[model samples]
Target: MQFDRKDKNNAVLLDLYTQLLYPRMVEEKMLILLRQGRIGKWFSGIGQEAIAIGSTLAMEENEYILPMHRNLGVFTARNIPLKRLMAQWQGKLNGFTKGRDRSFHFGTQDYKIIGMISHLGPQMAVADGIALADLISGQEKATLVYTGDGATSEGDFHEAINVAAVWNLPVIFLIENNGYGLSTPTAEQYKCQNLVDRAVGYGIEGVQIDGNNVLEVYDTIAAIAAKIRKDPKPVLVECLTFRMRGHEEASGTKYVPQELMDAWAEKDPVANFEHFLLTENVLNQELIAEIKADFKAGIEYEIEAAFQEEEPIANTIAELEDMYAPFNFKPNALSPDAPSTEVRYLDAITDALKIGMYKHDNLVLMGQDIAEYGGAFKITEGFTTLFGKARVRNTPICESAIVGAALGLSINGYKSVVEMQFADFVTCGFNQIVNNLAKTHYRWGEKADVVIRMPTGAGTGAGPFHSQSNEAWFTKTPGLKIVYPAFPQDAKGLLLAAIDDPNPVLFFEHKYLYRSLTGQVPQGEYQLEIGKANVLKEGRQLCIITYGLGVHWALAYMDEHPELSINLVDLRSLQPWDKNAVSNAVKQTGRVLILHEDTLSTGFGAELAAWIGEHCFSDLDAPVMRCASSDTAIPMNKVLEEDFLAKSRLAATIEKLLAY
Candidate 1:
């Protein structure tokens, strides 16, 4: 193809032939900022500008794109305000996140870019979902997702690509093959020689380009994207790029070979491009000089603006900000307005999901057996038929993928609801939930709207692994919402409320309650605000705090011991706990007891008791006591298992509290 020197875009391209020196210089300046205490850590895209700009040129501006830490080229090319990027580097509020979202993992709604996932390699599914959503909506936008070659090792990369290819979604997966991952070279890290080749397994188009050649990268991607628009299928574009900077701040080039660095730097992208353009007679000296001056001035303005920008204060998240969109407050969920409608517990669970899905379009449901099988307990019976397969999806048997997909999907305009076939299997996604979902919100103020439902709380004789309640693990996560429904009405209402809430929620349903539990439900759709504990029976002698199926056992024990006075309180939610209600009951009763089906020692019950003792010690007549399962993994024997749970021993504990 002949070069069009007269074209403005091509004229600018001539300047960019080795023009990334400006971007490279900016990367060095960022390092200076780190030493001076002006900024925190950084991931530089110094030598990899061609990959970013080249791959980006072929992308539709409206298409969804997920970026990684060292993706300044993607952000810069996409016009995601350069000054704001500087602000983000400085950990200031004016950046895209406004000090709320994580510095690296964020995007502007207006920009149409998505993600910077906490986990290294899960955003692929999010891009796929975006493409899937666009396809369904009849909008012809593609989803262009970028990841390091190192990320290909993640299971999500496989799961997402396989699904995307099979479904024929318009998504372009860009692999920035930057030779090394931190310290490990690709040759040593991956079993395969080329990443693009792996796309064959998924039946997707795979292409490789010289990542150093800017023009080649651009033209090739543009052609591929055009084909994607026509064919509307998945394609893998591998850009063989190289990293010149250290992985993070203060890291050394000690692991990187000096000879290779000197060699690659000699063929520096900026220098190579400039030489290429000059040799082609596409650019003259004066135009190139002017572009450099202009670029320098523009970046200086960004740096200055970033330093002048302000950071957010504490009151913003606690008081000033809207929970969801710009104007409306995310539904201020309501507890059942009155007594239960006298509905079955399973029906309440169904009603809860329905309410949330009805009130919020972003709320979506997905799980195995949920779509065609209607759930193992039929809790989601008819849901797929009502919501359609798009919203209520039946996923393959991959729990890690299921939860990980939910976490990624939440990055877009989605509030994902995921179901664990059994609560015990939640172990499969423990890392995503604990390391990513749990900390993402508090650490970055990023919104991870997810509802994970697990049938928990024992008594079904389904054996230890399937029957154990694991509320403590969720409660340990700082930013998650943990809600356990005790009654039919509360179950439905709280679950709906959790769906509408901005944080991730773990709604642990007691297996025994599926058919056995019953209560009056609200007439219309309703919500139960998270964190409020409901006192089922009021008494001055003692306080019993329990949730899930334990609430029933607590009530039964109260009825049996007519001579003993105890207030049975059902803690519907764990995180953002209702400290006021707990304190009031503790003060009134004099003696308090905390109870839950999760094993003792550092469990939710223990935390509750510890908090009560710490905060309400002066008002209490006796030291707070906790009734929980023995501190051991649930065993297989049914009778011994019954003996292991606090519910089985609640009567004696309540009597002990009553005696106090």
Candidate 2:
């Protein structure tokens, strides 16, 4: 290839070559490390460098890029140092994640890059959130999220794009259809000729291009980015490229056909782009050789220095410290002379949200039918009319996308309180809550100040799907605060506390008590300690530790049997339970009974029993007993529901404990 002195895009081509060279060198260094047994595995974006560099080059500053494992070229395009990545691969203290992570699974707020999870589709929803935040703030920016053909099959992909299209968010979804998803070929994966065809169903513009052509990919992205920045909307770009290596270094490609691999090898993105540069006289033979040699030497030097960096030791105290983001807010005490109004449990929660939104302009409310319909339980009636649609968002039926989007909003200076419609539906969004929302702070010290409001418990015969107390599910997961308040005052106070906290919080509201429970709520703002238990009544014979609807049942049983002397302790928070209060009550009574609305087997009550037995065994006169609903799913029949969480059954258990 000969050079022409007067080329128009010479500087652009040279810059692309410089950025593209970094990732290729990174892959080469990683391959050497993999062979040397220093790295466990390597997911190389060897032939797909053009798609990474081209797409990223089109993005402007402050725009977000959610990168997957195979999109390492984005790092090079963003000008991240090669040594930092090398140290991360080596699991050294100097790594970006400080040895917490070793793969492409990391992100920093400074770079506007979100670290991807092993599950590929969730980041798309997160990108929608990032774009939505900018759109709401009237900022001119877009979010670029990358995925592969395999991720297209995930429900999150559909849910994410659907929300982006409906809301008209400024997000560009780039899918690299790399012929094969690990071992399954595209022929076996989808029936459509092109993945872009699915965009019609989503009502969004879709474009297809030869991902191997760097200029084509770059031009497409640059054009779309310009249009979307002026008038925000989602656009899907399908880049038809092929992975030239196995899914990982150790995973051999026996399933890939030899002829297919050879055909794709002929159209290598890196080689083709370099030849294009030469034919256009953008670079001479000597200059190309020098550029490659310089990149190689630089990578080699970084790798050598990274090997000597000390690896971080696993420390329990450090792990505990990062479990929750620092939250310090000593709320003003409830004014004694302040006017009070009798409000139901549901209205109390609504009042708390209204107060939270009024205090913090960045507070956002999101859920299905929440904005217009005021939620299924009518907890947010008139919210949309008061706060406007921008703050009170009515989301689609996608649970995962709703929560995932809330995480994005949290990072972008918004406090999102997402309602799950029903607690049972939370399982649909479990991955985002457990893996993304629950672990975000622990992994990168980023506070995901998102509150998940769950309408929990059973009494209206809503059956297994609509009625279930699932607080124990989140209590088992770290990096989350669980609050289940039984009274109206506690519900309002705890919800305010949850919103104020600087970490992810799970706020459970018992559907049974929404209307039935009423109390005098303070008119002014106030917050309660999240992990403390309230002692409603004091006695001497036995101590009943309960929460949510269980408190009502325990109180009713005590009223029915006056001879049974007991103290009622309401555990408002499940995760950071009031251990001191529980211990003191058990010591005074010499007998303990734990109660909850969740199923009996492995319930939160079991944890309380274990703690009491282990910590206060000698202080107790009898073994700790637990009373809860049966392990079976909540039945629709009235008789079955009664027997499931029966007060009579609880009374029987209490009698035994008192007799002990």
**Top TM-score prediction, candidate number:** 2
Which stretches of model 1 miss by more than 4 angstroms?
Answer: 1-9, 12-22, 31-40, 98-103, 229-231, 311-342, 355-363, 407-411, 434-446
In terms of lDDT, model 2 sits at: 0.88
TM-score of 2: 0.97
Position 546, candidate 2: lDDT = 95
For 305-405, candidate 2 gives per-residue lDDT tens digits of 87888888989999887878998869668767778899888889989999999998888899999988899999899998889999999999999998989
Per-residue lDDT of candidate 1, residues 1-660 (tens digit): 133333446556754553455666677777787788877777777778877777776688877677777877777677777788887766687766566555567765577666566667667776766676565456776778888888888887887787678668788888998878888888876887799999888888899987777777778777777877777898998988788887775775688888988877865666777776777776678977887678778877889888998977767556333332221225444454543467788888888787766777666688877987888888788887778777787777666656666765676567788999899998877767776676555544457677899888677677768988888877876666788888887887777777776677888888888888777777666666787789888888888888887777787877777887778788888876888888889888889988888888888887888888899989888778888888777766888788888877777776676667
Worst 10-residue lDDT window, candidate 1: 320-329
Best by lDDT: 2
CA lDDT, every model vs. true structure: 0.75, 0.88
